[model samples]
Target: MDSKNRAKWACFGEIFEAVAQQGIDELDAVEALLAALRNGLRAYGYRRQFTFNESGKVERLPRDIYPQPVPVAIWRDSGTPKGDLTSIWQDDPEEPEVWISIDWVSGAVESLDWELTNFEHLRTDFSAIRIPRKEADHLLSDLAGRPKKRAGRPLGPSSPWEKEQVAAALRMIDGGDTRPATAIATGLTDTALIGKALESQQRRLTWGIKTALTGNAKNSANNKRD
Candidate 1:
């Protein structure tokens, strides 16, 4: 290992030890390790490309120009359920001269290894970093329960027309109108935006109804006692 790599490994070791000392769960430790690796690689002028194999179909995830932390659920979903998962970081998108590979089996990290190809002689004898697993099954279950992030350009600021439509839909919903009826009346075809606007209102309406029912039951009990 070169002096630069030795320094990087030392930094990683410090981070790993700090995370382990925090008494965090296995999944948290794994996430911390990944974050450390990504940050270190970014400092080393590496561009990261994420990909996963799902049901034997390999698909590359959207490339990130910035070093944004990817969610663990997305990583878990990239592989077959209860199967192996791998993430790679390379210095180049077309042809990477240096790269790091991390492999996981059912939410437990199996190996984290890196290689440098620019040397006069190929160097592939780096030892892998192994993290012991105590709650692999639990980790997998938790990851499965977490929602995966939708891959696409996020909706920008709502236009004035959209705001007006959402307001009209909410008003109709408040007046006991069904969502479809509100949509038809307001001419707002965006069901998703309407639903999002109504989410808090619906929750509050449900809570209010429950409270009213409970109050009625209490009044009836008082009347019986009287």
Candidate 2:
């Protein structure tokens, strides 16, 4: 959890303690107190996103819509100072405030640090405590007030296994060797090579499916065939 939310949860415990002595053992009172504490924490929340223009004033980006926090590696390349990100990001804030610092390892903006933050809440969620992946997702979904993010498009069917198979096939082709030799080099059995070849053929078919469905191959003979 971020420091602010951490403080809020801590304050909630304090509120519970103070009110427990008041003979308010009821759930409603406790819930109300917790809600009030959350509201107070929300009040202290600052705007992180912003819009900028040379001809006009900039408006603060809404916090509720902040992007999901992503873990980014900060590195300094050769001949450059450490923790300097001036080369990585845009030099001007004339664009929208799409990036914000959530937590820095060194507590300094220019320090070589890892920033852990949620960006675009539309695509992410936040929670009070860390949990296992399955439970964590369920908890976030329960707390989400807005529409949840989509699963997003798949890149392709090609994975590491397929990559190795393809590389082996290419090496065999380069050495003017036969398919059996390629299978041996790839550590795949003859049957496995046959399966992989079929899979590759299917992958090509799927790519064609995409082209036909999306009209992305408009100028190609592949499209003319349809």
Every candidate's CA RMSD = 19.8, 20.5
Compute each candidate's TM-score over C-alphas: 0.20, 0.18
Candidate 1 lDDT: 0.39
Going through the candidates in the order shown, the clash numbers are: 0, 12
TM-score of 1: 0.20
Q: Tens digit of lDDT per residue, candidate 1, span 11-129? A: 22333444345554544545634543334322121124322235442323454343233334333322222212345555575976544444432222221123234322121211223
lDDT of 2 at 51: 32
| lDDT on C-alpha atoms for all candidate structures | 0.39, 0.34
lDDT at position 88, candidate 2: 26
Per-residue C-alpha lDDT of model 2 across residues 53-88, encoded as one tens digit per residue: 565534444555432322222111111222321122
Candidate 2: misplaced stretches above 4 Å? 1-140, 143-163, 175-226
User: Which 10-residue window in model 2 sums to the lowest lDDT?
Assistant: 102-111
